[model samples]
Target: MEIVIINSSPRKNGNTAQLCDAFIKGAMQTLPKPKVTTVFLNDLKFKGCQSCFACKLKDSKRYGKCSLNDELSPILSAVNKADCLVLASPIYLMDVNSSAKAFLERLCFSLGSYEVGYRSLAPKEVIVVTIYTMNTTIEYSPVGAMDNVDAFLGHIFSTPRRLCAYNTYQFQDYSKYVVDVFDETEKLKYRDKEFPKDLLRAYDLGRDIATRL
Candidate 1:
Protein backbone atom coordinates (compact mmCIF):
# COMPACT_ATOMS: atom_id res chain seq x y z
CA MET A 1 0.00 0.00 0.00
CA GLU A 2 1.12 3.52 -0.69
CA ILE A 3 0.47 6.35 1.76
CA VAL A 4 1.43 9.87 0.76
CA ILE A 5 1.46 12.71 3.29
CA ILE A 6 1.50 16.26 1.98
CA ASN A 7 2.95 18.53 4.65
CA SER A 8 2.12 22.21 4.10
CA SER A 9 3.86 23.79 7.03
CA PRO A 10 6.84 26.04 6.34
CA ARG A 11 8.57 24.78 9.43
CA LYS A 12 9.66 21.23 8.75
CA ASN A 13 10.07 20.32 12.41
CA GLY A 14 7.02 22.14 13.74
CA ASN A 15 4.05 20.75 15.62
CA THR A 16 2.31 19.70 12.40
CA ALA A 17 5.33 17.68 11.27
CA GLN A 18 5.64 16.07 14.70
CA LEU A 19 2.09 14.77 14.51
CA CYS A 20 2.82 13.38 11.02
CA ASP A 21 5.91 11.66 12.39
CA ALA A 22 3.89 10.06 15.14
CA PHE A 23 1.37 8.86 12.58
CA ILE A 24 4.10 7.36 10.44
CA LYS A 25 5.57 5.60 13.44
CA GLY A 26 2.24 4.04 14.29
CA ALA A 27 1.63 3.03 10.72
CA MET A 28 5.04 1.40 10.56
CA GLN A 29 4.21 -0.89 13.50
CA THR A 30 1.52 -2.63 11.53
CA LEU A 31 2.24 -5.88 9.66
CA PRO A 32 2.86 -5.66 5.90
CA LYS A 33 4.00 -2.11 6.48
CA PRO A 34 2.87 0.30 3.82
CA LYS A 35 5.26 2.44 1.82
CA VAL A 36 4.98 5.94 3.27
CA THR A 37 6.10 9.06 1.41
CA THR A 38 6.25 12.61 2.77
CA VAL A 39 6.11 15.63 0.52
CA PHE A 40 6.82 19.07 1.97
CA LEU A 41 4.87 21.69 0.06
CA ASN A 42 6.98 24.51 1.42
CA ASP A 43 10.00 23.02 -0.28
CA LEU A 44 8.36 22.85 -3.68
CA LYS A 45 8.11 25.45 -6.41
CA PHE A 46 4.55 25.48 -7.61
CA LYS A 47 1.43 27.62 -7.79
CA GLY A 48 -2.34 27.16 -8.00
CA CYS A 49 -4.08 25.76 -11.02
CA GLN A 50 -4.15 27.76 -14.19
CA SER A 51 -7.60 27.78 -15.81
CA CYS A 52 -6.38 26.10 -18.95
CA PHE A 53 -9.31 23.67 -19.07
CA ALA A 54 -7.05 21.08 -20.69
CA CYS A 55 -8.26 18.45 -18.27
CA LYS A 56 -11.86 19.23 -19.19
CA LEU A 57 -11.34 19.04 -22.93
CA LYS A 58 -13.56 16.30 -24.21
CA ASP A 59 -11.76 13.36 -25.84
CA SER A 60 -8.39 14.89 -24.99
CA LYS A 61 -5.46 12.81 -23.84
CA ARG A 62 -4.95 15.19 -20.89
CA TYR A 63 -8.51 14.74 -19.73
CA GLY A 64 -8.78 14.28 -15.96
CA LYS A 65 -5.13 15.19 -15.48
CA CYS A 66 -3.38 18.39 -14.62
CA SER A 67 -1.28 19.68 -17.52
CA LEU A 68 0.91 22.04 -15.57
CA ASN A 69 4.35 20.51 -15.53
CA ASP A 70 6.15 21.61 -12.37
CA GLU A 71 7.43 20.29 -9.08
CA LEU A 72 3.90 19.51 -7.89
CA SER A 73 3.05 17.64 -11.08
CA PRO A 74 4.88 14.47 -10.12
CA ILE A 75 3.49 14.63 -6.60
CA LEU A 76 -0.04 14.89 -7.97
CA SER A 77 0.57 11.86 -10.15
CA ALA A 78 1.81 9.90 -7.14
CA VAL A 79 -1.27 10.89 -5.15
CA ASN A 80 -3.45 9.66 -7.99
CA LYS A 81 -1.94 6.19 -7.50
CA ALA A 82 -1.62 6.32 -3.70
CA ASP A 83 -3.86 4.18 -1.53
CA CYS A 84 -4.07 6.95 1.08
CA LEU A 85 -3.51 10.69 0.75
CA VAL A 86 -2.96 12.74 3.91
CA LEU A 87 -3.14 16.53 3.85
CA ALA A 88 -1.20 17.83 6.86
CA SER A 89 -1.18 21.57 7.38
CA PRO A 90 -0.72 24.22 10.03
CA ILE A 91 -3.65 26.62 10.14
CA TYR A 92 -2.79 30.17 9.15
CA LEU A 93 -5.35 32.94 9.61
CA MET A 94 -8.04 30.45 10.55
CA ASP A 95 -7.59 28.45 7.34
CA VAL A 96 -5.23 26.07 5.62
CA ASN A 97 -1.99 27.64 4.45
CA SER A 98 -1.54 28.83 0.88
CA SER A 99 0.36 25.77 -0.23
CA ALA A 100 -2.39 23.41 0.88
CA LYS A 101 -5.06 25.50 -0.83
CA ALA A 102 -3.10 25.66 -4.07
CA PHE A 103 -2.35 21.95 -4.01
CA LEU A 104 -6.02 21.14 -3.48
CA GLU A 105 -7.06 23.42 -6.29
CA ARG A 106 -4.72 21.74 -8.75
CA LEU A 107 -5.55 18.23 -7.61
CA CYS A 108 -9.32 18.47 -7.20
CA PHE A 109 -10.17 20.84 -10.02
CA SER A 110 -8.73 18.45 -12.57
CA LEU A 111 -10.27 15.30 -11.12
CA GLY A 112 -13.74 16.84 -10.65
CA SER A 113 -15.72 16.80 -13.85
CA TYR A 114 -18.18 19.35 -15.22
CA GLU A 115 -20.70 16.60 -15.90
CA VAL A 116 -24.40 16.68 -15.12
CA GLY A 117 -23.85 15.34 -11.62
CA TYR A 118 -20.40 16.93 -11.24
CA ARG A 119 -18.85 13.49 -11.24
CA SER A 120 -15.24 12.69 -10.42
CA LEU A 121 -12.95 11.52 -13.22
CA ALA A 122 -10.21 10.22 -10.95
CA PRO A 123 -8.39 7.09 -12.01
CA LYS A 124 -9.33 5.34 -8.79
CA GLU A 125 -10.84 5.96 -5.38
CA VAL A 126 -8.28 7.02 -2.79
CA ILE A 127 -8.63 7.42 0.97
CA VAL A 128 -8.34 11.02 2.11
CA VAL A 129 -7.36 12.46 5.51
CA THR A 130 -6.81 15.99 6.72
CA ILE A 131 -4.63 16.83 9.72
CA TYR A 132 -4.84 20.41 10.99
CA THR A 133 -2.61 22.01 13.61
CA MET A 134 -3.43 25.43 14.91
CA ASN A 135 -2.48 27.88 17.63
CA THR A 136 -6.09 28.62 18.56
CA THR A 137 -7.99 26.51 21.08
CA ILE A 138 -10.77 24.21 19.94
CA GLU A 139 -13.49 26.70 20.82
CA TYR A 140 -11.73 29.58 19.09
CA SER A 141 -10.43 27.68 16.09
CA PRO A 142 -12.20 27.98 12.74
CA VAL A 143 -14.20 24.79 12.99
CA GLY A 144 -15.65 25.09 9.48
CA ALA A 145 -12.44 26.15 7.83
CA MET A 146 -11.94 22.85 6.03
CA ASP A 147 -15.58 22.16 5.21
CA ASN A 148 -15.37 23.20 1.57
CA VAL A 149 -12.16 21.28 1.00
CA ASP A 150 -13.63 18.18 2.58
CA ALA A 151 -16.80 18.52 0.54
CA PHE A 152 -14.84 18.80 -2.69
CA LEU A 153 -12.68 15.82 -1.78
CA GLY A 154 -15.74 13.83 -0.75
CA HIS A 155 -17.27 14.44 -4.12
CA ILE A 156 -14.10 13.30 -5.85
CA PHE A 157 -13.12 10.40 -3.59
CA SER A 158 -14.74 9.82 -0.18
CA THR A 159 -15.44 11.71 2.99
CA PRO A 160 -12.07 12.32 4.58
CA ARG A 161 -11.09 11.40 8.15
CA ARG A 162 -10.32 14.72 9.81
CA LEU A 163 -7.93 15.29 12.73
CA CYS A 164 -6.86 18.44 14.51
CA ALA A 165 -4.35 19.60 17.09
CA TYR A 166 -5.34 22.83 18.75
CA ASN A 167 -3.49 25.40 20.81
CA THR A 168 -0.19 24.39 19.31
CA TYR A 169 3.12 25.62 20.63
CA GLN A 170 4.29 28.16 18.07
CA PHE A 171 7.61 29.31 19.31
CA GLN A 172 10.43 27.69 21.20
CA ASP A 173 11.09 30.81 23.34
CA TYR A 174 7.97 32.93 23.46
CA SER A 175 9.82 35.66 25.34
CA LYS A 176 12.14 36.15 22.43
CA TYR A 177 9.25 37.11 20.21
CA VAL A 178 7.33 40.36 20.56
CA VAL A 179 3.92 38.65 20.76
CA ASP A 180 2.07 39.46 23.96
CA VAL A 181 -1.43 38.19 23.21
CA PHE A 182 -0.83 34.73 24.65
CA ASP A 183 0.61 33.94 28.02
CA GLU A 184 3.79 31.97 27.46
CA THR A 185 3.51 30.15 30.73
CA GLU A 186 0.01 28.92 29.96
CA LYS A 187 1.03 27.87 26.45
CA LEU A 188 3.97 25.94 27.85
CA LYS A 189 1.75 24.31 30.43
CA TYR A 190 -0.73 23.21 27.80
CA ARG A 191 2.02 21.90 25.55
CA ASP A 192 3.47 19.96 28.40
CA LYS A 193 0.11 18.57 29.52
CA GLU A 194 -1.83 18.04 26.28
CA PHE A 195 0.56 17.79 23.37
CA PRO A 196 1.47 14.23 24.18
CA LYS A 197 -2.17 13.27 24.18
CA ASP A 198 -2.57 14.83 20.77
CA LEU A 199 0.40 12.87 19.45
CA LEU A 200 -1.04 9.68 20.93
CA ARG A 201 -4.33 10.33 19.22
CA ALA A 202 -2.52 10.84 15.93
CA TYR A 203 -0.74 7.55 16.39
CA ASP A 204 -4.00 5.75 17.06
CA LEU A 205 -5.58 7.35 14.04
CA GLY A 206 -2.76 6.17 11.79
CA ARG A 207 -2.91 2.66 13.23
CA ASP A 208 -6.64 2.48 12.71
CA ILE A 209 -6.34 3.69 9.15
CA ALA A 210 -3.63 1.17 8.39
CA THR A 211 -5.68 -1.70 9.79
CA ARG A 212 -8.67 -0.70 7.70
CA LEU A 213 -6.54 -0.48 4.58
Candidate 2:
Protein backbone atom coordinates (compact mmCIF):
# COMPACT_ATOMS: atom_id res chain seq x y z
CA MET A 1 0.00 0.00 0.00
CA GLU A 2 1.14 3.52 -0.74
CA ILE A 3 0.56 6.45 1.61
CA VAL A 4 1.46 9.95 0.46
CA ILE A 5 1.92 12.98 2.70
CA ILE A 6 2.02 16.55 1.44
CA ASN A 7 3.65 19.09 3.74
CA SER A 8 2.86 22.58 2.55
CA SER A 9 4.48 24.51 5.37
CA PRO A 10 7.70 26.29 4.47
CA ARG A 11 9.30 25.41 7.79
CA LYS A 12 10.42 21.84 7.38
CA ASN A 13 10.73 21.20 11.13
CA GLY A 14 7.75 23.22 12.26
CA ASN A 15 4.59 22.07 13.99
CA THR A 16 2.95 20.99 10.77
CA ALA A 17 5.87 18.79 9.81
CA GLN A 18 6.05 17.35 13.31
CA LEU A 19 2.47 16.17 13.08
CA CYS A 20 3.17 14.59 9.71
CA ASP A 21 6.10 12.78 11.24
CA ALA A 22 3.99 11.51 14.08
CA PHE A 23 1.39 10.22 11.67
CA ILE A 24 4.04 8.47 9.62
CA LYS A 25 5.56 6.91 12.70
CA GLY A 26 2.21 5.46 13.71
CA ALA A 27 1.48 4.24 10.21
CA MET A 28 4.83 2.51 10.02
CA GLN A 29 4.03 0.47 13.14
CA THR A 30 1.06 -1.24 11.56
CA LEU A 31 1.14 -4.86 10.38
CA PRO A 32 2.07 -5.22 6.71
CA LYS A 33 3.54 -1.74 6.66
CA PRO A 34 2.76 0.56 3.77
CA LYS A 35 5.22 2.53 1.67
CA VAL A 36 5.09 6.19 2.71
CA THR A 37 6.30 9.19 0.71
CA THR A 38 6.54 12.74 2.08
CA VAL A 39 6.61 15.67 -0.30
CA PHE A 40 7.50 19.16 0.85
CA LEU A 41 5.75 21.68 -1.37
CA ASN A 42 8.03 24.54 -0.36
CA ASP A 43 10.98 22.63 -1.82
CA LEU A 44 9.26 22.26 -5.20
CA LYS A 45 8.89 24.74 -8.00
CA PHE A 46 5.29 24.71 -9.28
CA LYS A 47 2.21 26.77 -9.83
CA GLY A 48 -1.51 26.23 -9.68
CA CYS A 49 -3.48 24.75 -12.58
CA GLN A 50 -3.21 26.86 -15.71
CA SER A 51 -6.84 26.41 -16.73
CA CYS A 52 -5.73 24.69 -19.95
CA PHE A 53 -8.70 22.31 -19.79
CA ALA A 54 -6.54 19.49 -21.14
CA CYS A 55 -7.77 17.12 -18.50
CA LYS A 56 -11.36 17.78 -19.54
CA LEU A 57 -10.91 16.89 -23.14
CA LYS A 58 -12.62 13.61 -23.93
CA ASP A 59 -10.05 12.35 -26.44
CA SER A 60 -6.96 13.74 -24.72
CA LYS A 61 -4.37 11.26 -23.55
CA ARG A 62 -3.96 13.22 -20.31
CA TYR A 63 -7.65 13.25 -19.56
CA GLY A 64 -8.30 12.96 -15.82
CA LYS A 65 -4.68 13.89 -15.08
CA CYS A 66 -2.85 17.15 -14.60
CA SER A 67 -0.90 18.03 -17.76
CA LEU A 68 1.45 20.47 -16.08
CA ASN A 69 5.00 19.19 -16.39
CA ASP A 70 6.84 20.52 -13.35
CA GLU A 71 8.12 19.41 -9.97
CA LEU A 72 4.56 18.85 -8.77
CA SER A 73 3.62 16.57 -11.66
CA PRO A 74 5.05 13.36 -10.30
CA ILE A 75 3.77 14.14 -6.81
CA LEU A 76 0.27 14.55 -8.18
CA SER A 77 0.59 11.26 -10.01
CA ALA A 78 1.64 9.55 -6.80
CA VAL A 79 -1.30 11.00 -4.92
CA ASN A 80 -3.66 9.64 -7.54
CA LYS A 81 -2.29 6.15 -6.98
CA ALA A 82 -2.01 6.39 -3.19
CA ASP A 83 -4.08 4.23 -0.89
CA CYS A 84 -4.19 7.14 1.59
CA LEU A 85 -3.25 10.84 1.42
CA VAL A 86 -2.42 13.32 4.17
CA LEU A 87 -2.27 17.07 3.58
CA ALA A 88 -0.51 19.01 6.34
CA SER A 89 -0.26 22.78 6.33
CA PRO A 90 -0.02 25.81 8.55
CA ILE A 91 -2.99 28.13 8.37
CA TYR A 92 -2.06 31.49 6.94
CA LEU A 93 -4.49 34.41 6.82
CA MET A 94 -7.26 32.23 8.22
CA ASP A 95 -6.85 29.48 5.62
CA VAL A 96 -4.36 26.96 4.32
CA ASN A 97 -1.01 28.35 3.20
CA SER A 98 -0.40 29.30 -0.44
CA SER A 99 1.46 26.11 -1.34
CA ALA A 100 -1.36 23.92 -0.08
CA LYS A 101 -3.89 26.02 -1.93
CA ALA A 102 -1.96 25.80 -5.17
CA PHE A 103 -1.40 22.07 -4.85
CA LEU A 104 -5.09 21.46 -4.20
CA GLU A 105 -6.15 23.54 -7.16
CA ARG A 106 -4.15 21.40 -9.54
CA LEU A 107 -4.97 18.07 -7.94
CA CYS A 108 -8.68 18.63 -7.52
CA PHE A 109 -9.33 20.38 -10.82
CA SER A 110 -7.65 17.74 -12.92
CA LEU A 111 -9.49 14.85 -11.32
CA GLY A 112 -12.85 16.60 -11.41
CA SER A 113 -14.84 15.92 -14.57
CA TYR A 114 -16.96 18.48 -16.41
CA GLU A 115 -19.77 15.99 -16.84
CA VAL A 116 -23.42 16.67 -16.19
CA GLY A 117 -23.02 15.80 -12.54
CA TYR A 118 -19.52 17.23 -12.25
CA ARG A 119 -18.26 13.81 -11.35
CA SER A 120 -14.77 12.90 -10.22
CA LEU A 121 -12.41 11.17 -12.65
CA ALA A 122 -10.01 9.99 -9.98
CA PRO A 123 -8.56 6.51 -10.47
CA LYS A 124 -9.65 5.40 -7.02
CA GLU A 125 -11.26 6.63 -3.81
CA VAL A 126 -8.27 7.30 -1.62
CA ILE A 127 -8.58 7.93 2.10
CA VAL A 128 -7.98 11.58 2.91
CA VAL A 129 -6.79 13.43 6.03
CA THR A 130 -6.00 17.09 6.68
CA ILE A 131 -3.77 18.53 9.41
CA TYR A 132 -3.81 22.23 10.23
CA THR A 133 -1.58 24.24 12.56
CA MET A 134 -2.43 27.84 13.39
CA ASN A 135 -1.74 30.63 15.83
CA THR A 136 -5.40 31.49 16.10
CA THR A 137 -7.49 29.89 18.80
CA ILE A 138 -10.25 27.53 17.72
CA GLU A 139 -13.03 29.86 18.85
CA TYR A 140 -11.52 32.72 16.89
CA SER A 141 -10.96 30.75 13.70
CA PRO A 142 -13.05 31.67 10.70
CA VAL A 143 -16.02 29.42 10.22
CA GLY A 144 -16.12 27.38 7.01
CA ALA A 145 -12.61 28.49 6.16
CA MET A 146 -11.80 25.12 4.61
CA ASP A 147 -15.25 23.99 3.56
CA ASN A 148 -14.68 24.55 -0.14
CA VAL A 149 -11.34 22.77 -0.14
CA ASP A 150 -12.82 19.89 1.80
CA ALA A 151 -15.73 19.70 -0.64
CA PHE A 152 -13.41 19.43 -3.61
CA LEU A 153 -11.32 16.73 -1.99
CA GLY A 154 -14.42 14.87 -0.88
CA HIS A 155 -15.77 14.84 -4.40
CA ILE A 156 -12.52 13.65 -5.89
CA PHE A 157 -11.70 11.16 -3.12
CA SER A 158 -13.09 10.54 0.35
CA THR A 159 -14.23 13.14 2.84
CA PRO A 160 -11.13 14.12 4.81
CA ARG A 161 -10.67 13.49 8.50
CA ARG A 162 -9.39 16.70 10.07
CA LEU A 163 -6.73 17.28 12.78
CA CYS A 164 -5.83 20.70 14.05
CA ALA A 165 -3.42 22.38 16.44
CA TYR A 166 -4.65 25.80 17.38
CA ASN A 167 -2.79 28.69 19.01
CA THR A 168 0.51 27.10 18.16
CA TYR A 169 3.82 28.45 19.31
CA GLN A 170 5.16 30.46 16.40
CA PHE A 171 8.71 31.26 17.41
CA GLN A 172 11.42 29.41 19.27
CA ASP A 173 12.56 32.58 21.02
CA TYR A 174 9.76 35.10 20.91
CA SER A 175 12.29 37.74 21.86
CA LYS A 176 13.91 37.58 18.43
CA TYR A 177 10.71 38.42 16.55
CA VAL A 178 9.23 41.92 16.55
CA VAL A 179 5.78 40.68 17.36
CA ASP A 180 3.86 41.61 20.48
CA VAL A 181 0.39 40.39 19.61
CA PHE A 182 0.72 37.20 21.62
CA ASP A 183 2.08 36.60 25.08
CA GLU A 184 5.18 34.50 24.75
CA THR A 185 4.73 32.93 28.14
CA GLU A 186 1.24 31.74 27.33
CA LYS A 187 2.30 30.46 23.94
CA LEU A 188 5.08 28.44 25.51
CA LYS A 189 2.77 27.07 28.14
CA TYR A 190 0.24 26.00 25.55
CA ARG A 191 2.85 24.45 23.35
CA ASP A 192 4.33 22.57 26.26
CA LYS A 193 0.90 21.32 27.30
CA GLU A 194 -1.36 20.94 24.26
CA PHE A 195 0.94 20.32 21.32
CA PRO A 196 1.95 16.92 22.59
CA LYS A 197 -1.71 15.94 22.76
CA ASP A 198 -2.16 16.98 19.18
CA LEU A 199 0.79 14.84 18.15
CA LEU A 200 -0.65 11.89 20.00
CA ARG A 201 -3.99 12.39 18.30
CA ALA A 202 -2.27 12.50 14.93
CA TYR A 203 -0.55 9.25 15.70
CA ASP A 204 -3.82 7.63 16.74
CA LEU A 205 -5.51 8.87 13.61
CA GLY A 206 -2.85 7.40 11.39
CA ARG A 207 -2.70 4.03 13.10
CA ASP A 208 -6.46 3.68 13.19
CA ILE A 209 -6.88 4.53 9.55
CA ALA A 210 -4.05 2.28 8.44
CA THR A 211 -5.21 -0.65 10.49
CA ARG A 212 -8.76 -0.32 9.28
CA LEU A 213 -7.63 -0.19 5.68
Candidate 3:
Protein backbone atom coordinates (compact mmCIF):
# COMPACT_ATOMS: atom_id res chain seq x y z
CA MET A 1 0.00 0.00 0.00
CA GLU A 2 0.95 3.64 -0.43
CA ILE A 3 0.94 6.40 2.15
CA VAL A 4 1.40 10.13 1.67
CA ILE A 5 2.56 12.56 4.31
CA ILE A 6 2.10 16.30 3.94
CA ASN A 7 4.48 18.30 6.11
CA SER A 8 3.42 21.92 6.61
CA SER A 9 6.05 23.21 8.97
CA PRO A 10 7.78 26.41 7.87
CA ARG A 11 10.84 25.51 9.89
CA LYS A 12 12.73 22.71 8.23
CA ASN A 13 13.77 19.95 10.64
CA GLY A 14 11.68 21.55 13.39
CA ASN A 15 9.65 19.70 15.99
CA THR A 16 6.74 19.10 13.62
CA ALA A 17 8.98 17.68 10.94
CA GLN A 18 10.72 15.51 13.49
CA LEU A 19 7.46 14.01 14.64
CA CYS A 20 6.37 13.31 11.08
CA ASP A 21 9.69 11.62 10.36
CA ALA A 22 9.35 9.46 13.41
CA PHE A 23 5.87 8.41 12.38
CA ILE A 24 7.06 7.55 8.91
CA LYS A 25 9.87 5.53 10.36
CA GLY A 26 7.49 3.49 12.44
CA ALA A 27 5.15 2.96 9.52
CA MET A 28 8.07 1.74 7.44
CA GLN A 29 9.07 -0.72 10.11
CA THR A 30 5.57 -2.15 10.28
CA LEU A 31 4.96 -2.58 6.57
CA PRO A 32 8.59 -3.05 5.55
CA LYS A 33 7.67 -2.44 1.94
CA PRO A 34 4.98 0.19 1.87
CA LYS A 35 5.52 3.07 -0.52
CA VAL A 36 5.65 6.37 1.39
CA THR A 37 5.99 9.86 0.02
CA THR A 38 6.54 12.97 2.11
CA VAL A 39 5.62 16.35 0.66
CA PHE A 40 6.86 19.56 2.19
CA LEU A 41 4.47 22.50 1.76
CA ASN A 42 7.21 25.09 2.16
CA ASP A 43 8.63 24.14 -1.21
CA LEU A 44 5.33 24.48 -3.02
CA LYS A 45 3.67 27.57 -4.47
CA PHE A 46 -0.10 27.47 -4.13
CA LYS A 47 -2.78 29.92 -3.16
CA GLY A 48 -5.78 29.38 -0.91
CA CYS A 49 -9.19 28.52 -2.23
CA GLN A 50 -10.89 31.44 -3.94
CA SER A 51 -14.46 30.14 -3.52
CA CYS A 52 -15.14 30.48 -7.23
CA PHE A 53 -17.28 27.32 -7.30
CA ALA A 54 -15.90 26.72 -10.77
CA CYS A 55 -14.77 23.29 -9.77
CA LYS A 56 -18.40 22.30 -9.38
CA LEU A 57 -19.60 23.63 -12.70
CA LYS A 58 -21.78 21.08 -14.49
CA ASP A 59 -19.72 21.30 -17.68
CA SER A 60 -16.42 21.14 -15.82
CA LYS A 61 -14.73 17.79 -16.04
CA ARG A 62 -12.25 18.91 -13.40
CA TYR A 63 -14.94 19.63 -10.89
CA GLY A 64 -13.72 19.37 -7.32
CA LYS A 65 -10.26 20.10 -8.60
CA CYS A 66 -8.46 23.39 -8.36
CA SER A 67 -8.31 25.22 -11.69
CA LEU A 68 -5.34 27.26 -10.65
CA ASN A 69 -2.33 25.67 -12.33
CA ASP A 70 0.43 25.44 -9.73
CA GLU A 71 2.69 23.09 -7.83
CA LEU A 72 -0.16 21.81 -5.66
CA SER A 73 -1.71 19.96 -8.55
CA PRO A 74 0.85 17.19 -8.38
CA ILE A 75 0.64 17.01 -4.60
CA LEU A 76 -3.13 16.75 -4.74
CA SER A 77 -2.78 14.11 -7.40
CA ALA A 78 -0.54 12.13 -5.07
CA VAL A 79 -3.06 12.52 -2.27
CA ASN A 80 -5.74 11.14 -4.53
CA LYS A 81 -3.66 8.07 -5.21
CA ALA A 82 -2.47 7.37 -1.70
CA ASP A 83 -4.19 4.77 0.50
CA CYS A 84 -3.57 6.84 3.60
CA LEU A 85 -2.74 10.48 4.27
CA VAL A 86 -0.93 12.13 7.16
CA LEU A 87 -1.21 15.86 7.83
CA ALA A 88 1.56 17.19 10.04
CA SER A 89 1.93 20.77 11.11
CA PRO A 90 3.02 23.04 13.91
CA ILE A 91 0.27 24.91 15.70
CA TYR A 92 0.47 28.64 15.26
CA LEU A 93 -1.59 30.83 17.57
CA MET A 94 -3.52 27.73 18.70
CA ASP A 95 -4.43 26.74 15.14
CA VAL A 96 -2.95 25.22 12.00
CA ASN A 97 -0.07 27.02 10.40
CA SER A 98 -0.80 29.43 7.56
CA SER A 99 0.58 27.06 4.92
CA ALA A 100 -1.35 24.15 6.34
CA LYS A 101 -4.53 26.22 6.51
CA ALA A 102 -4.11 27.33 2.94
CA PHE A 103 -3.55 23.77 1.78
CA LEU A 104 -6.66 22.62 3.63
CA GLU A 105 -8.77 25.40 2.21
CA ARG A 106 -7.76 24.49 -1.29
CA LEU A 107 -8.25 20.78 -0.71
CA CYS A 108 -11.65 21.31 0.91
CA PHE A 109 -12.89 23.57 -1.81
CA SER A 110 -11.68 21.27 -4.55
CA LEU A 111 -12.55 17.90 -3.03
CA GLY A 112 -15.52 18.68 -0.80
CA SER A 113 -17.88 19.30 -3.69
CA TYR A 114 -17.18 16.08 -5.53
CA GLU A 115 -16.84 13.75 -2.58
CA VAL A 116 -20.00 11.80 -3.31
CA GLY A 117 -19.24 11.01 -6.92
CA TYR A 118 -15.52 10.57 -6.36
CA ARG A 119 -15.61 8.67 -3.14
CA SER A 120 -12.92 6.28 -4.31
CA LEU A 121 -10.50 9.14 -4.86
CA ALA A 122 -10.46 10.01 -1.20
CA PRO A 123 -7.88 8.55 1.13
CA LYS A 124 -9.17 5.67 3.24
CA GLU A 125 -7.36 6.78 6.39
CA VAL A 126 -6.12 10.10 7.74
CA ILE A 127 -3.68 10.90 10.56
CA VAL A 128 -3.15 14.38 11.96
CA VAL A 129 -0.02 15.48 13.83
CA THR A 130 0.29 18.78 15.65
CA ILE A 131 3.28 20.08 17.56
CA TYR A 132 3.19 23.04 19.90
CA THR A 133 5.30 24.88 22.46
CA MET A 134 2.58 25.33 25.05
CA ASN A 135 2.55 23.86 28.54
CA THR A 136 1.40 20.24 28.49
CA THR A 137 -0.37 20.53 31.84
CA ILE A 138 -3.11 22.70 30.32
CA GLU A 139 -5.96 20.29 29.67
CA TYR A 140 -7.26 22.09 26.62
CA SER A 141 -4.14 23.40 25.00
CA PRO A 142 -3.37 20.46 22.70
CA VAL A 143 -6.85 19.02 22.19
CA GLY A 144 -8.14 22.41 21.13
CA ALA A 145 -5.97 22.33 18.04
CA MET A 146 -6.45 18.60 17.44
CA ASP A 147 -10.24 19.00 17.52
CA ASN A 148 -10.09 21.45 14.66
CA VAL A 149 -8.10 18.96 12.59
CA ASP A 150 -10.49 16.15 13.46
CA ALA A 151 -13.42 18.26 12.32
CA PHE A 152 -11.63 19.00 9.09
CA LEU A 153 -10.89 15.34 8.52
CA GLY A 154 -14.48 14.40 9.26
CA HIS A 155 -15.56 16.73 6.48
CA ILE A 156 -13.11 15.41 3.90
CA PHE A 157 -12.71 11.72 4.53
CA SER A 158 -15.59 9.26 4.41
CA THR A 159 -13.82 6.73 6.66
CA PRO A 160 -11.47 8.87 8.67
CA ARG A 161 -9.55 6.32 10.69
CA ARG A 162 -7.37 8.02 13.33
CA LEU A 163 -5.94 11.26 14.63
CA CYS A 164 -2.75 11.82 16.62
CA ALA A 165 -1.35 14.98 18.19
CA TYR A 166 1.95 15.57 19.95
CA ASN A 167 2.73 18.59 22.07
CA THR A 168 6.06 19.68 23.55
CA TYR A 169 5.79 22.07 26.43
CA GLN A 170 8.40 24.46 27.76
CA PHE A 171 10.37 24.21 24.59
CA GLN A 172 11.03 27.90 24.20
CA ASP A 173 10.69 31.27 25.93
CA TYR A 174 9.92 29.93 29.38
CA SER A 175 11.48 32.95 31.04
CA LYS A 176 8.75 35.39 30.02
CA TYR A 177 6.52 34.44 32.93
CA VAL A 178 7.43 35.63 36.37
CA VAL A 179 6.20 32.46 38.03
CA ASP A 180 7.81 30.14 35.51
CA VAL A 181 10.68 28.05 36.78
CA PHE A 182 12.32 27.12 33.52
CA ASP A 183 14.25 29.55 31.37
CA GLU A 184 14.46 29.58 27.56
CA THR A 185 17.60 27.46 27.46
CA GLU A 186 16.23 25.21 30.12
CA LYS A 187 13.06 24.73 28.10
CA LEU A 188 15.18 23.75 25.12
CA LYS A 189 16.96 21.26 27.30
CA TYR A 190 13.68 19.80 28.43
CA ARG A 191 12.57 19.32 24.87
CA ASP A 192 15.80 17.57 24.08
CA LYS A 193 15.24 15.29 27.02
CA GLU A 194 11.66 14.55 26.06
CA PHE A 195 12.15 14.19 22.32
CA PRO A 196 12.40 10.41 22.46
CA LYS A 197 9.15 10.02 24.38
CA ASP A 198 7.34 12.30 21.99
CA LEU A 199 8.73 10.40 19.01
CA LEU A 200 7.72 7.06 20.50
CA ARG A 201 4.09 8.12 20.70
CA ALA A 202 4.19 9.39 17.16
CA TYR A 203 5.70 6.12 16.02
CA ASP A 204 2.97 4.15 17.72
CA LEU A 205 0.31 6.22 16.05
CA GLY A 206 1.86 5.49 12.68
CA ARG A 207 2.08 1.78 13.31
CA ASP A 208 -1.52 1.74 14.44
CA ILE A 209 -2.65 3.30 11.19
CA ALA A 210 -0.56 0.89 9.18
CA THR A 211 -2.11 -2.05 10.98
CA ARG A 212 -5.59 -0.77 10.30
CA LEU A 213 -4.75 -0.35 6.64
Q: Rank the candidates by TM-score, best first.
A: 1, 2, 3
Q: In candidate 1, what are the lDDT values of residues 1-213, reduced to their tens digit?
A: 999999999999999999999888877777356899999999999989999999999999999999999999999999999988889999999889999999999999999999999989888899988899999999988778778778888888878988899999999999899988999999999999999999998888888888867
| Candidate 2 regions with alpha-carbon error over 4 angstroms | none
TM-scores of the candidates are 0.97, 0.97, 0.78
lDDT minimum window of 10 residues, candidate 1 = 24-33
Ranking of candidates on lDDT, top first: 1, 2, 3
What candidate 3 gets wrong by more than 4 Å, as runs, is 114-137, 140-142, 158-182, 185-189
The C-alpha RMSD of each candidate to the native structure, in angstroms, is 1.0, 1.1, 4.0
Candidate 2 residue 189 Cα shift, in angstroms, is 0.8
Per-residue alpha-carbon lDDT of candidate 2 for residues 79-138, written as tens digits (9 for 90 to 100): 999999999989899889899999999999999998989999999999999899999999
Clashes per candidate (backbone, < 3 Å): 0, 0, 0
Best by lDDT: 1
User: Higher TM-score: candidate 1 or 2?
Assistant: 1
Give the candidate number with the greatest TM-score.
1
